[model samples]
Target: MKYVNEAYDFVNHAWSKGKIKKLIAPLEGLAYCTTVKGFKEVGLGVQPEESNYFNFFYPKGRFHDSLYGDDFPAEDLVSDCICEAVKQYIEGANSEFQVPFVRILIDLMSNPRFTYLRDGETEKKYVHVIPDDDNAYLLALRGEFLAKFHFGNKSDADDEYRAEFTSEEIDEMRKMSDLAIDWSKVNYESA
Candidate 1:
């Protein structure tokens, strides 16, 4: 849960500096700003080094600084979208335990958001996030689905045998996760 602490630290620092409000402003539709703040409070010291802590919450981007800039590219403007989506989903999940580190790593790689820049123009940059519930939820669902699929047989550890699933299978799973999240209404009001 070290990375949880890191997430908390990141948010807490922002809060102390009066930036948490702006950081989560885009999440108003997905979850209340206060609720998102509360989520960060509980996440304090949870896991300080988990990669998803960054990918899910902070993401790989410069969008955070864009709030003060003028005219960000459409595709480079969704970091907040990704972070809020991830934080809200993690909060909604019924589990108190952390996703395995390996799974988290896989999620960082296999998630489609990591592969394509927002407009497919930039070469895999994480400048901005889409900041939409559908996009965020789809990203999370894709992470979870990939974990369930490629992450089987944890002990196999053989690098060569690791590459079994096809790009088609991965795409199919992503589609399914997106559909599930799209049709999902139970707990939709909470976040």
Candidate 2:
């Protein structure tokens, strides 16, 4: 349970700082130790003097000692468990939401005549806003983007999808898109 708590804290710290890359080494090490050959390679081989009361007749080997020894930090054990959980969460979010949302945004951005329909009806559609519309266009785009992305489904359900992305990530996406649009506008005007 102590190891589990430590693992939870480690994951939270890494996630908060957007340092998901830090989990890679532990994940790789866990992967490497899954096979018998890998276990033998990584494991601290046979120890002769180590004997538990239950196994007094038969002393523990190097592999057993390596696992139970004080030298093996609790961090390593919990890291493997936490890293697997994080990996699964990322995969699920990517497949279920992120990829689809990005694809929909890209498709919409490429089409000049694209309109976001609040309902499936023409009367409820939101067409591209004019330059004089102030923030109306951005609001429309956000609504349409969220609608098309089906983000409402997850947003209504305790916002589990929001945990998959950091605020910086969302901001970066907006910044990049704005920069690209500004560049395009300047080039179009010059030409």
Candidate 3:
């Protein structure tokens, strides 16, 4: 059975933290390939709007590779894994999306499954931190303890432990973020 509280925590952090923007803040106007969350091939654009908030854009389905080291796209044949970013894929996407790109990458990076299988141990219960589409962080369990950090895709089983955003929640966040963002901070440019 899926744990609701765990899922909620994961999503809360994933939604609230601006991981993508934090990571991308340093790489303005750079061209790079992406494979995070099934998004492929990306080039991020950042320019401040009249209100002083930065406007970020990328192809409809693209993410940064390095920022999503843990959950970057896998080779599985299954297709179509859209996240909240999809809303911004449209031309002139709202500035509210400016934060999630980085947060999503941060969440994806947090899900690591490096096992420390011992020679004399078996059936050990383990726990892990995982992030999901709904922008939540949750705990993942395994037969044994594993390191919290790694650089590879997780098993199919791990996919089941994710949370998702309801259309309502996405809209709520979008609206809330629009109010919470302090545009003045986004006015500065990188050297």
| Top candidate when judged by TM-score against the true structure | 2
Candidate 2 stretches with Cα past 4 Å from truth are: 1-5, 10-17, 25-33, 38-47, 50-63, 66-191
Q: In candidate 1, which residue ranges exceed 4 Å CA deviation?
A: 1-77, 89-94, 100-110, 113-191
lDDT by residue (1-191, candidate 3, tens digit) is 11212222333346433543343345332223232222222222211222322211223323323322222222111111112222222222345545444454344333342112233232222112222223222222211222121212344444543222233433443365433433233221110
lDDT of each: 0.30, 0.30, 0.28
Residues 1-191 of candidate 1 have per-residue lDDT tens digits of 11222334334345432443443344334322212111111111122222332222222221112112222222233333444334543444457875543344345335543323232222211111223422222111123113332221324343221222233433464476433432223112111
| Per-prediction TM-score to the true structure, in the order listed | 0.17, 0.19, 0.16
The best-first sequence of candidates by TM-score reads: 2, 1, 3
Writing each residue's lDDT as its tens digit, candidate 2 over 21-139 gives 54343344432343222121111222222231011111121122222322243234334445445444455553644543234324433343222223212111121123443322221
Clashes per model (N, Cα, C within 3 A): 20, 2, 11
The local lDDT score (0 to 100) that residue 137 gets in candidate 3 is 28
Q: Cα lDDT for residue 61, model 3?
A: 26
